[model samples]
Target: MSAQLFVVATPIGHLDDMTFRAVEVLKSVAVIAAEDTRQSIQLLRHFNIITPLTACHDHNENMVIDQLIGRLKNGENIALVSDAGTPLISDPGFKLVRAAQEHGIRVTPVPGACAAIAALSSVGLPSDRFSFEGFLPSKSSQRLLQLEKLKDETQTLIFYEAPHRILASVKDMAQVFGADRPVGFAREITKTFETIKKMTLAELVSLIERDHNQQKGEIVLVIGGAAKEVDLDQLKLDQLLTRLLEDLSVKAASQLAADLSGVKKKIAYQRALELTAEKEQDKLDRDLN
Candidate 1:
C-alpha cells in the first residue's frame, strides 16, 4: 500500500478534546508537519507521542512543499496539524494538501475540534445554512466595507475574530447590520471560561464595552442574517396601484404605492405605468366599439 497524508485536528483549548484516532495517527505517522513546532511539542509531550515534527505554516509551507511531498512519495506516512483547531480552517496546510492530491497521494482527515463548528453547534443560531466568513479586516474602514457587502445576506453569518478586535468588529456589525440584529457570541469555547450567549448586536457591543473580559478569548460570532422582507401580494399591489392611478399621476401614484406597500419606488412606478397604459387601451377599445 502507498503512503498516505493524514490531516489531524488537535485540541483548540482543552487537551482532552484530542480524539483517539488523532493520537493513534500522530503516533503511527513517520513524521508530523505542524504549523508551529513549539506549540505542537507541548501537545505531543502531553500525549507522549514522540513523532518527529516539522514546520508547515503559511510563511514556509510553499518553500517546504517539495520536501514534504518527496517524503510522502518515499512511502512515509505523515500527519499535518495546527497549533489549535483543524488545519486549513483559517489555519495553514491547504497548499500541502493540494500538492499531495495533485501527486495522487491519499489525504485523510482525522477530524475532531474546529473552533467554527464547535462554536456553531452551541451558539443557538440556525445551523441549517450558514456562511463562515473567516476573519473580517483588521482596519475599521476595511472591516466596515466588508460588513456593508454582507448587510443583506439572509443566511446566518459566522465569523472568527481576534480578542483585540472583537469590540470594534461588533460595533461595526451593529452599524451595518443594525443594532437590533441578533447574534450569538461564543468565547473560549470548550475551555474553562466558555461563554455562549444569544443577544442583540447592541447588547453585544455593550457587554464587550462594559466588561473587558468578554473582549478576551478565541471569539466566534454567529450573527443572525437580515430579516427576509415579505413582499406584498402582486394582485393586491396591482389593485392598489390602479386605485391610486385613478386620482394621482404615475409619479405620485408610484410614490404613494411604494410608501404604502414597502416596495421600491422604481418598481412601483413601472407597475403604475403598465396599469395606466392598460386603462387607456380599454378606453380606446370601448370608443371603437
Candidate 2:
C-alpha cells in the first residue's frame, strides 16, 4: 500500500516455490520492474497477477532508473522481480535499489527461493562460512585469473556457471585446485531432470564428459575449500633452516621454520641440528684441505 520498493523473489524453476507473500506483493504493486517482462508475464499469468509489467534489465536499468525512482517519489509503490530467483544476485537492479535508498525510499525484501542457497543447502559442503561468488567469468583468461586469486581461499566457494561453460570452468577449477578437491555439482535445481552429484573435481569432470545430457540447464557449483596440508618438502625445510640459522640459534630457527612450513616443531628442531652439524663438518673438512 505504501510507496515503497518491494524486492520480490520468484521461483528459480519450480513454480510451487513462489511464496504467497511474494505473489501478494506483485498483485498490490502499481508496477513490476522485471528483468524480462515476457518471461515474467508468463509467471504472473500463472499466479493471476495482472500488475503492469516494465522491463528493467541489465541493458536499460541505468537509463530508466531515475524514471522508476521518480514514480516511487510520486507515491507509487513498485515491486522489483527478476526472471527467476532473487533479483540483484548475479542479476540486475543494484543501481535502482541504490538510487531508491539514496532518495529516502524504503526497499523491502520478499524473500523466497534462491538457486544459490537451494543448491548450497543439499550440496553437503560447509555452509557456515561460504562465499557466493555468483557467476564465473566467461572469458578463459579472466576466469583463470579469478580462479588463481581464489586458489588459497579456505572457505567453501559457490559459483553459478552456464551449461556451455560448466565443463570448462570445472576443468579450470580442477587445474587450479587440483583433481582431489571436492565438488558438488547441482544442475537444473528445483526442476525435472535435476541432478546433484557430490564427488571430487576429477570425478565430476569425468562424469560430465561422458554424459552429455548433464550439460543442459542452470548449474550451481559448490566446491570445498583446500584442505590444510602439512606435507612440506624436506628441501624447502632445509632452505628455511639454512637462512634462519644465519641470524638465530637452532631452536629459534627451527621454531620459525615449523611455523612457516607447517611442519612439526620437534621434526624441524632435529633437522636444524643435522644442518648445523653438517655445516660444522664441511667447515672442518675445508680447513683440513
Candidate 3:
C-alpha cells in the first residue's frame, strides 16, 4: 500500500482555528514538511505535537523534494504544511505535491483556515463568482499593467497583499478601476486586531494613507467586479432618435443618435425617417381638429 501524503492546514492567526484532524495528522505523520521549520515548530510545541519538521520552502523545496518523496515511497506517512494557512495557497509545496502524485503516492487534503475564503465570506460582495489573483507583481509598473487587464472583469476579484505594499496597491486599484469602485478591505484576519470593511476604492486609499496601522498585517483585498454592461435594444434606440429629431435634421439626428447609442448610422437614418413621418401626421391631424 502507498503511504498517503497529508497536506494539512495551519491557523492563519488564532491558534484555536487549528482543526482536530490537522493536529492528529501532524502528530501521527512520520515527519512534517514545513515552509519554515522555525515558525512551524512553535505551533507544533503548543499542541504537544513532536513531529519533526523539515524545511520545504520556495528556496529549498526543489532540493529536498526527492528526499521527502523517497521517505513517502518507503511507506512512511509525511505531512506537508505552510508557515500559515493551507499549503500551496500562495505558499510553497506545489512541486512536492505534484511529484508525490506522479509517483502514484496518495495525496490527501486536511482542510482548515484559509485567509482568502475567510474574507470573501464576510465582505458582502458578489460571492457567486470570484477570481483569486494571488499576490500581484511587487513592481509598481508590472502591477499597473496587470490591473489594467482586469479592469473589465465581471466577477468579484480577490488579492492577497503584503503589508508594505497595501497602500500602493489600493492606490493603483483606484487609479485603474476608478475611485468609485467598491472594495472590501480585510487586515490581520482572525487576529486580535482583525479589521474587515467595505468602502469605495477612493475611501480605502484615504484611510490607509492617514492610518498607518491599516498598512500593517496580513491583508486580503476583495474588489467588486466591473459593472455588467447593459445592452441597448431597438425600442430604446428609436426613442433616442425621436427625441433628437425634434431639434435636429434627419441626417443630424440619425448621426447623433447612432453615436450616442452605438447603433449603425444607416439603421438610425431609416428609423429617423419613420419618426419624422409619424410626427408630421400627428401635426396634420391636430391642425384639422
For all predicted structures, in order, the TM-scores are 0.80, 0.79, 0.81
Lowest-scoring 10 consecutive residues by lDDT in candidate 2? Answer: 226-235
Q: Which candidate leads in TM-score?
A: 3
68-109 per-residue lDDT for model 3 (tens digits): 999998999999999899999999999999999999999999
Q: Give the TM-score of candidate 3.
A: 0.81
The global C-alpha lDDT for each of the candidates, from Candidate 1 onward, is 0.94, 0.93, 0.95
Deviation (Å) of 8 in candidate 2:
0.5
Clash pairs, candidate 3, are none
Give the Å error, residue 95, model 2.
0.5
Residues 123-209, model 1: lDDT tens digits: 788889999999999999999999999999999999999999999999999999999999999999989999999999999999999
Local distance difference test, candidate 2:
0.93
Error of 3 at 105 (Å): 0.7
